[model samples]
Target: MPAKTKTSFHKPATWSDVAPLLVDVAMGRQKADLVVRNGRWVNVHSGEIIPATDIAIAGGRFAYCGPDASHAIGEGTRVVDAAGRYLVPGLCDAHMHVESGMVTVTEFCRAVIPHGTTSMFIDPHEIANVLGLEGVRLMHDEATAQPVNVYVQMPSCVPSAPGLENAGAALGPKEVNEAMAWDNIIGLGEVMNFPGVAANDATMRGEIAATVAAGRTVGGHYASPDLGLPFHGYVAGGPEDDHEGTRAEDAIARVRQGMKAMLRLGSAWYDVASQVKAVTEQGLDPRNFILCTDDSHSGTLVKDGHMDRVVRHAIAQGLNPITAIQMATLNTAQHFRLERELGSIAPGRLADFLIVSDLAALTIDEVYGRGVRLARNGQLEIDIPAWSYPASARNTVKLGHRLAAKDFDIAAPKGTREARARVIGVIENQAPTRALEADLPVAKGIVGMDRRNDVCQIALVERHRGTGAVVNGFVSGFGYTQDCAMASTVAHDSHHMIVVGTNKQDMAAAANRLGQVGGGVIMFSKGKELALVEMPIAGLMSDERAEIVAEKAEKLTRAMRDMGCSLNNAYMQHSLLALVVIPELRISDVGIVDVTQFAKVDLFV
Candidate 1:
């Protein structure tokens, strides 16, 4: 009933003013606002569980956390009997993109609260590419107004790769400095230009210098699997944490270089299983590692879980539940220098925690944020206010003109019948794509789709500038084998329209359809629309509730399956198809990018 005070979470400086009141409650001079009794405290700090623990909260913070809170309780105090359940610190997602959830920050908070994710460190570079600094400001204010802790990392790479593609907006060291002064910006977002950083490029190094000078952390994205000198050079460049490791060695190398190894298990990326082996088998310090979901679509957030899902998956992958919990909670907080703030259930910390019936299974029975009971039994108990994006933030799908089947034509050499072309080979359930080559048959000078080898057409349609420039390329591994096409404006980094189909007509239809409704994902099959989840907000996020988006996303997944595309969380793969920062090959507005070389390559070899 407390209106879920934002000052309690966002404005931690106010805690200095309120700490005296909490001290009074601890000393039994003042009555506590809320108290929990007879619970097993999963003390992440000590890596052990203490039984029959009692906690007293005042001013949305823990005043007393000991065996008994009877001295602090009074007639005005609201008591909740834990009934001998595990009292765990609320889970925290160290690194994520709120836009990846296909919902706004408020909606994302609402969806994940029931799953016991009380805190998130989000990098809004996706929106930064669309609306620039003003766009980030909108989300920052929204994040600050939430019932939970949502920290923003200033986007370090707006275009992601400098010359590879053009984003809607551009940010540099000046923008980074301006954003560092924000109340909620904990650090600079993932320094994705690993090549630039390794080479000591002025802009990339300047942004890192500014973030470090501001005394904030620098998020890392060393997508390269090579643990050689390039990786060493990047680590020396001052990125404190990295979530791009997809191998056990990658995790080991990062932690050895004094960077936090963030093990992520998003809807599509299964990096945790391979990387957590660094801790389980190699016996590295688990504290040097963190857990995160780099990107999860709406369905994963609502149907599965958030950080809770990641923690459980880690446990199932030979990690101790308490250690996995530590990886998700205290480790993350410590990475962002928030350990003394909200990662644990200690005195002087916010009363943000969870009541779990099973630690190993992570069955969250109740969720709390800043001492407020936000959810219970996998359902939200309190109201999470809705946030509306301004008109400037909507209708961002700017296609210069309607596209037709001829627009997707990939012409071959004048006299060639079959041409060897460079193709972006998608690896299933992984973030990295393979640079593949295939000989394709040419029809009327245009390259044709190879359905027998599961290859289809992938094009990046210019949406930001409305140039109507369609960059055509080939991609295999979706297993799509029908007269179907899937298009989305949720293209990573640049937020362009990525259209993939076995038939060019359907691909053109899908692109034109998104142009009509601002932006979103759509699947067109056999000359009919199968599914559409209208985002309308910068072509990335939906204004609808989390459940509605999740349902539509489910239908979209069904449509992908119906069209013979069999890849887990294929939507995530589709979105990242245009992310040129990640290797080995990707399509961009410029042309097909060979991410390994970080340069544009000829479509035909």
Candidate 2:
């Protein structure tokens, strides 16, 4: 039997046809598809904030925006009185990862739309790492079905660092070529391995060549801050935009090299304030700057906001409100070659906008998407379905058997009372970690964690197969107290289980909890489970609704805070334990990576 038919919305042919419809709606002679009256239009195009404006939308596009609305009140038109709220263009996140939210695409959209985010440029590299080209296509198809604009970027770095990571799937030039032909694919995802680009690696060149040949954007991820010859070489490699800029100089260099500098402010990474200085202070062109949330978790989106939080942070950093809004809206849309359909409240653009009370505070009163009111008064009005991931995507945590306390014990060199060990230090609200060496005492020829030194044991349990190979090490900066343990299967690219705790038994219990539930994040304190988010799909996202995942994540974060961990958004730092790409230190299924040197290293000295 044939599959159920999908609903198709009408698309306007040109602006000429859209203008009279706008006039008819405003004059109240013809009914509008949806009308938002008495709003202060925060027009990003003209950089003006016009008060007492009315907006008319039809066919999922803006039909009119003006002061009068007497003619657009025909029968059967859905009318929403704005009550003098500011009508700003729908926000656009220039770069992000849906997997980082720990929820599926349907859920991620539900979490952010109420916060006024109507468009996103997502890179599904995490799923691609586990399921290859099929995974990327699945995400693309799902994103196209959404009412909001969810553009997919083809995964550019599957393994991320080839020869360094053994991912579930590998993508080459063939995959890139195929993805380029997809309808919703915006461009190539973040080219993470800048070293490979500079060294002229064949795989990197081949993927970039495919994307360039397709006339699409090549996203960049130059994590290194050094603005030298290698930086120049990376720019020459054809990435048109970069979002890893953490400093003012990094932003300046990217703009100078003709690339849009994306300033991100996610849960852990507070990069926007530091990098936006290039435009606000160094006289760099504002057009070359964009705003994004590179890696926001579900909790951050539900508790705080999405691009709204980033724009507020930029404003507090002394940037003009208009400029910040522009960075998050039009600038992002232009970068992805989607300026015509989105990023503004102009005619022919998607009817997506936020009704706000104040520009500085960004107090959103209502949000509209596809000519419909999806959210109002900080709550979602539309009901989104739970995304169904294939059964093969579940039970990814194949730890063979339950983990034991002995698996977490790191044995010291023979006949040594003490040893100098390499510990992974978690830097609060930052991506780069500090490589710290500590001298610790040994017990029964094994290294022990020093509670007084804020040191805790960290274990990477191989979950891809039933290989219960647990590699143990030490970590700092969590400030976890009361013999607690936290375990998650959302460990970076590989999505392995990373457990950190001061008590050995708790570490074992935490790992076992994830194993029992298939895969998810869990916190165990004093032998009692505190919180868990069941992300059974590929061990990264849940089949549950987005709100349910957000609520669970909130509980997990609050549990962390109650455990005496005060670092802002520490959960994000916890999930990056197995990233294996960020500098200084990271853990993978293979071993701990000294990312500064791009090589694996011994855990003890």
Candidate 3:
């Protein structure tokens, strides 16, 4: 192997001037900082792969890309022997929540960077709902400190669904205005209150106005699948992109309405395949489609993959490889208006690229961020420090007292031997759950579980302010045969304690286990606590390193899989029990929310 040379070039006046800079770097007249030799460059810009190319980087940005080696190389430049690999741009997740990883922003970055995710558009809505504007700022500041690009999107729906469940703190239009002016804020977070937008609610309109005034993107979440008048009304509300689509038609409708359709593949949500078909088969313009992972837990990032998984799934859905990569990279960057700075591996863009053995397999042989090698062969070469959350974020699981089985008992209508109970059925690989009604036998004026119908017990323990209130209900779809239970204080948006179980004792044990560890996810089986992932910060995230959190999360996931539950990515479904926005039925500190109507409803009809 010959020694590589360094090269440098002045900023080009136009895209037409790039060829001269490429020649200068290749001739080594100007020293380049680093060189990657002999790779298949997947140019997402032109949708072509120029074979046997070399890439040069300087000042953390791509300085040159071509077939020659003489000009760009200098005495001190570092050379990476690509040895015939596919060079692809690092992925960018269009919309996501860092808190969903059960780790801090820094930890989440550490987990995903090695998997070739160099940028993300994150919404701190979960923390904003817990700690208010201060929480959003905290996450924003931390995100900026990372070496990779982690753009913040100001939370638009702090309460998620007003009047349905109360958040610890709320954000109004003023907060939105202030966040839009922040330096690293790319846009407004997901407008979760879609109904409010369609209804022309003043608060929702004000928030949108603030974002538009600041020239920032307004993210969307039209969770309802009904493409009726309400959907049209929401389209008129000015959201630039939407990731809530689950079907091909849903995606097509969004694009037709002038919204970027962000198809997603998260831990629990397998929505990309059904929706990406809109681009692959329906003749929809692929430029309007984006790829994202809305809520990937640490286990999914570490043990499986990050945006790489989404890209692979998209390709598996019959999309062209380059088109799928473009969705994860350039399309997302363009959506956030960061295309010039970070998307493609070209001049003036951040030098983030993945060296892969095969384009289709996406076997990342080496990963680079900010013009430096960060990981090689699926292992991190750099060490990222653990972040410290405030003491106020600790022990958020403040139930006033120890919980008992009686607290979980849902009483039937007076003097009735049987009553019609409202049940929430968990849907596999989807966010929308079913609203089921079942008649159950009564014992001591309390409705008993109808195991034949797969109805199990679900409880929401009030953690904020130590209310010690346990609102219990019934849920179906987890075919738990043994006396097993699972609990988590990492409930979405509100960070409350949610426990689901087939046995009362096990449910109590699971809830108590999380309480003992401040907060986290725990599973109890046959009187033994089987798994726990301790998230001590706000009862929503662990302060430990990402790898540590990821390891624990992997165990918890395996435990769920071993317990006779086969719903794909059930842990994510477990975390959303307190998400009051998405409808059908959900539990919160107030009680069960009939999400369809955005109101509190009695557990027993």
For model 1, where is the 10-residue window of minimal lDDT? 1-10
User: Which regions of candidate 1 deviate over 4 angstroms?
Assistant: 1-13
Query: Across residues 1-605, which tens digit of lDDT does each residue of candidate 1 receive?
Result: 33443333344435687889988999999999999999999999999999999999998889999999999999999999998999999999999999999999999998999999999999999999999999999999999988889999999998999899999999999999999999999999999999999999999999999999999999999999888999999999999999998889999999999999999999999999999999899999999999999998899999999999999999999999999999999999999998878899999888899999999999999999888888988988777667889999988988899999999898898899999999888888899999999999998888898999988899999999888899999999999877999999999999999999999889989999999999999999978999999998889999999999999999999999998988999999999999988999999998989998999999999
> What are the per-residue Cα lDDT tens digits for candidate 2 across 1-605?
33322434333335565667665554556677887888888888888988888877866678778886646666777787888878889999989999889888988888898889999999998888777898888888889767688989998887888777667788988999988998888899999888889989999999999999998999999878678988999999988989887889889889989999999999889998888888888878798899999998887888898999999999999999988999999999888887888898877788889888888989888788877777877887776654577777777778877777888888898889998999999988898888998999998888998888888889888877677788788899998776889999887776678898988888899889888888889989888999999888787888777667888988998888777688787878988877776788887777878887889899886
Across residues 437-472, which tens digit of lDDT does each residue of candidate 3 receive?
899999988789987778888888877778787888
Candidate 3 versus the native: TM-score?
A: 0.93
Residue 216 displacement (Å), model 2: 1.7
Which residue pairs show backbone clashes in model 1? none
Q: Tell me how far candidate 2 lies from the true structure as C-alpha RMSD in angstroms.
A: 3.9
Error of 3 at 224 (Å): 0.6
Model 3: how far residue 495 lies from native, Å: 2.1
**Candidate 1 global lDDT:** 0.92
Sort every candidate by TM-score, greatest first. Answer: 1, 3, 2
Q: Identify the superior model by lDDT, candidate 1 or candidate 3.
A: 1
